[model samples]
Target chain A: MEKRVLMKGNEAIAEAAIRAGCRYYFGYPITPQTEIMHYMAKRMVEVGGTVIQAESELAAINMVYGAAAAGARAMTSSSSPGISLKQEGFSYIAGAELPAVVANIVRAGPGLGGILPSQGDYFQATKGGGHGDYRNIVLAPASVQELYEMTIEAFNLADRYRMLALILGDGALGQMMEPVVFRDKEPIDLPKKPWAVTGTGGVRPHNTITSIYIKADVLEAFNRKLQAKYAEVSRREVRAECLNCEDADILMVAFGTCSRIGRGIIPIAAAQGVRVGLIRPITLWPFPSDVIARAAAQPSVKAVLTIELSCGQMVEDVRLAVDGMKPIAFLGRSGGNLPTQKEILQKIMKMVGR
Target chain B: MQAVFKRTAGLLNIPTHYCPGCTHGILHRLIAEAMCELDILHRTIGVSSVGCTYNNYEYFACDMVQAAHGRAPAVATGIKRVHPSKSVFTYQGDGDLAAIGTAEIIHAAARGEKISVFFANNAIYGMTSGQMAPTTLIGQVTTTSPFGRDPDAQGHPINVSEMMATLPGAVYVERVSLHDYRHIIQAKKAVRKAFRVQEAGLGFSLVEVLSTCPTNWGMDPPKSMDWVAEVMIQQYPLGLFRDPKLEESK
Candidate 1:
């Protein structure tokens, strides 16, 4: 029987990471994500793992860089401002092709915006906030259960692809309490990291992990290699869910907490004798552009409504996906505020011209 | 015939890209020698810091990872924590460690991270073609400080060895120069001691070697050596600044 318990999303994610064989965690405190670090600090030692309260987010990410290079399952977590501070290290990790798990329990931001829930980091997270050419395997969880499942999946994907896997959450999901079931997962068989810097022992040639290539040809080739990997990921990984789009006049697009609010729209729209559907993007980077495009091409769908906590971010991606085929409307509540189901229903009705 | 003096196997038999008269080669040799003597080269992981020696990973015959600027200490902390029984060390330049990575190095020392740090303080950013570094002397002339470093404009040079010694977590702290053969010998000893301290599970250990940038300094190798002894030593004195083992012995 799988163990079921009531837990906060942040704590559940941390516990799931431990169960997934992550042995080292380095992090600093930030609102909405502090519980992740606190739980790790208390439990990692009991499981024969290590946890460190790094001096800063910069230090925390670099520590993760080190631990990953040393062939350890390592992770770090932070909020908006703190995640911004880790961009440099993220670029380094991606360039070096090291495996790591980075969690951004996002809050509103252009700067030190607020401690409330927001998805304002859409571009920064998907478009590579760090310098150089790189992209993270960004996963968005819409509930505590998804948070636990995605946290484990992130480790597998990171090790499988030898890339940085990011969990993009919001303050709402991070702080919300929910009943979660811990299922026994099959043991993940990760590839042996022969290139790791865990002592050469003179048994083989020395291994080096570096991103610097002074020669233009060499740097270009490295960039091409990264592009090939990303292309493969896009082909194999894009994940999203569609609901009630078989015969609907309007389709709604959202993710994470916003998607939960979007689900409320389906029931409310039905009672009002309206047809509405939703498509939640679970993997935001290798975004489900094809699905959205195809859905928008359907005859019954008149428009696509994108609801987010930011003024407008994912809307651009939605537009890119739809490519002006149908009218794309956007509704967002920024500055750490969340929109209500009534507000969303009202916006849906307005877009449908009800 | 037997070998009287030969290169240690700790270093790969590759011709380094270092400029003539640069001490980076000498520093690499000293570290390689120490690793061979300590017999931990096989179990050692080296973190190479950014700068001229950013690619030192090619020269060392051990598992190596390149770090961004002064994040070497933090990287080393990560490696050491994962493989505690294995030795971990970082090779960083003065500009990388003292200026950009000050927070990383300071906090690593404060946490008493069990790793060895080999800081090469040449007082100028050699890779970027002669910019004034945090360790550049008060009146040291560089591209950025054309009229010589102005105290009013550039502020005073930081004495990292002296500053780092104040941290309780630093178990071994020493500053040696590589201006001449005799000083180079002392530097090798310092490098060995730094690694030995790590071997014994001591806290953070560091050896700050006053290196020379002959190309960036616009001086020949010989003249640069003399300038280091005659001038650089005046602003940055040499000797052991901290050693907890010495304290416990006393």
Candidate 2:
């Protein structure tokens, strides 16, 4: 039997990343996300990996860019403000078509709002946080176990698509402790990175890893290729967990820690005789929109409500996904505050007109 | 009845977009020669700067990556750390290195990153039609400093080589010029030596080449060479500023 141990969410991300064959971790220290760096700093050397406590978030992201270009499994983690600093490098990484994993342990922020749990970066992560035309495979984990599992999966997705992969979590999930199991999973066989900038060793034509194409036609072609990749990812990789969504009058949509709150709201609403179900998005970018629309399309479902840690960021996507088929509502707690299960249950009851 | 000379295989056989007398071509040739002689052409990755040479990836025969304006050093740092066995070098201009990328280069050097830097200091932003650069001389006139640079207003010119030499992580630092044949040869030697330092796993190494922008400087080819010798050299002197091995011996 595998040993189950209690660990912080951030530690699970680090250990899982190492087991996932990530040998390079470059990050700057920030609130709610520093544990990832601390764990890596302690054990990376023993695991024959390298941990770079970079000067700033900018340096950290660029280091990941270099390591990724050289065909190493590289990653960086930061909270809201630090992730913002990394945007320039992110744009470069996307343009260069390098595979990298970035984790944003979210804190409330327009600008350094507070070091607490908030899903304020929904649009930034799902949309383009960096400048330019690009998309990242955004994963949102609701539990510590999922955090560990998603981190390992993130590396695989990144290499599979040759694109940026993002894991979005908030301070609450990052700080929370839960029982986690470390599994000895078999290694995944990713395709050879023939385009990596490793020494050619005089074996083939020198390979250049760049995002620059001065010609308008060449750039347009490259953009078309990227769009094709995004389409394939969206078609094949949309992930969501639907619970009790079958016979419901009200469907609740949430993700990350908010989903855990929704899980609590379900049992309470059931006891009170309200048929409220959930469609929790695990992949936030290729955002399980079809699942959401189908759940909302249920004959018994009358309304959809999105509860987030921010003021209606993910609600926009829900609105778009639902297409005004049903009345949609939003409830949020911003600036590091969290909503309670009672509040969500009350909202569900009101939506049911009871 | 012999082949007098041949272009180094490290450079692609294509005409450059550089102006008739701009020393960027000279610097490119020197770097290519260095790569060829070192026999690291296959294993080398060049990080191109976003200046006049933004598309230099097309000119170099090795693996190349074009970095954002002023981010080549950071990008090169990334590439080198992952594949330490491969040779990594960043080719940057004055505006790219001295202005926007100051923090990146300084930090990469401070960390003792094992990479070579080829800094082309033309004292002006050549690509964007001649704005004053960080290395612009005090009395130099450009689009930004039309009435010549006033120190009180614009601040003093930066001697990047001297500043870089102060960092303990910087193992080899040299400032060379591409004015005449003699200095051009020396500049080539400096480029080779900088790469050698990285090949030997010495810490950060850089060769600051004082180049010319004839089109931007409003000077003809020959006059630009003279200006590089007579004017640019006086402000940014040509010499080796740091050598770890030499320092240890002393």
Candidate 3:
């Protein structure tokens, strides 16, 4: 039987990771996400797991890299500035195709912006922030329920794709407390990892995990194979939620914490006699562009109002998805300020001439 | 009626790609033989560090993972923690282990991670050509230190083994040189001892092998060996610096 509990988003993610068989947790304390490291530190030891408070964010992520390479379920969490420190390790993990979970409870960015919730890191999360041509499987959670569910899914996706999985949340989401019912208490049946560095034991030949392909042709071949895997993921794993867009005039595209605000504005716009629908992207990387394009093809959909907490990061993807068939407008308040439902409704009224 | 020359039981018979008179070949043989003798060859996982021997995975007859520059220690720590039943070790070069990977090795040791570290100190970066390394002698001249290593400008050379020995978490730490046949034997013993400590599930063990880079040293193979014994040893003395067994006796 599933148990109901009142938990913050950060605590929920930590619990979900433990129930999902994550045994190693390495992290450094940072705002809005410190509860995750605190929770894991107390719980992991009780369950015969390991929790390490690394010296720095750089050390924490490398510890994750180490644990993941050893075939253990591992994770780390931090905010914007801390995540920046982890970029090098994250890139190496991605390049090696090692499975690990990184939770970014984003605050304002571009150098220690603020400690409040912001979606400024949308571009960094989607586009590989470190050196090299690589991609991370980014999962954007809109609520406490999603914060728990997506963390489990993040581990699964990371293991499946042999890549880093990011749980992209914000300060508001991490700090909010809500009722959450776990899916099940059943033990997770992880797939066998034949590629991990868990020793040979004479059962098989030695396996090497590496990203250094010096020869041009060899590296080219590796890049082609990686591209193929990415393509497969994009075709099969793109996910998003569409709310009441069949007969709507304006389509509102948002994700993460911004999606909740967009959802809140939905009824307000409807009461004002302005038709507005919300399209929330669940997976930000293998983006749900196909869904957006299909919605844009509808004759009733005239414009896409992209609401975010950044200047215009995710708005670029919405514009690309809409493909100029409909005019795309953006409304945002960065550096820790959130757009309220009243502000969103006013923007919709201005757009629809209500 | 019997084979006069045969490949070592644990070592792969493939001819090594190391330059003539390179000590890496000898070190590999020692590790392989140790694994075979200990009956842990099948259960051993080697994490290869970034350097001239980055492709060491091809040489070891065990599971291997090639880590990014300075990350092998972290990788080995991961593998060891996950599969405690398996023997895990990292083979790193002076530049890879002592310079770029200083933090990684230091933290791994401080955490008392049960793994073996084989630090090959040639005092120069061989893979990238004769560049000055962290362990490069104070007066040494290389491509990057053509004016000779200036103590004020380039900083002083680091004694990695001695420094590591001071850490309380390190159960075993030793410095050995492959300058002569006798010292080469001692170096092999040190390597084997480090592996043995890890196999016994003791805390972090490290063996720093003072080696010679003949091509980079601008000397012939034999002359470089002599230089290692006569000069390198003067700056970086070789001997056991820490041993858990010694502490137990007291």
lDDT (C-alpha) at residue A148 in model 3: 95
Candidate 2, residues A142-252, lDDT tens digits: the string is 989999999999999999999999999999999999999887578656569988877667787767778888889999999999999999999999999999999788899
Where in model 2 is the C-alpha error above 4 Å? A188-190, B246-250
lDDT of 1 by residue, A68-154 (tens): 999989999999999999999999999999999999999998899999999999999999999999999999999899899999999
| Predicted model 3 interface RMSD | 1.6
TM-score of chain A of 2: 0.98
TM-score of model 1's chain A, to 2 decimals?
A: 0.98
lDDT of 2 at B180: 88
Worst 10 residues of 2 chain A by lDDT: A182-191
lDDT of 1 by residue, B144-244 (tens): 99889999999999999999999999989999999988999999989988988888887899899998999999999999999999999998899899885
| Per-prediction CA RMSD (Å) | 1.7, 1.8, 2.2
Q: Write the residue-wise lDDT of candidate 3 on B1-250 in tens digits.
A: 9998656766666677788877888788888888887788888888888888898887888888877788777777767767888888999999999998899899889988889999999999999999999999998999999989999999988999889988888999999987788987887778778877886777899999988899898999899999988999888898888887732221
lDDT of 3 at A296: 79
Q: Report the C-alpha displacement of residue B115, candidate 2, in angstroms.
A: 0.7
Clash list (residue pairs), candidate 3: none
Q: What's the CA error at residue A318 for candidate 2, in Å?
A: 0.4
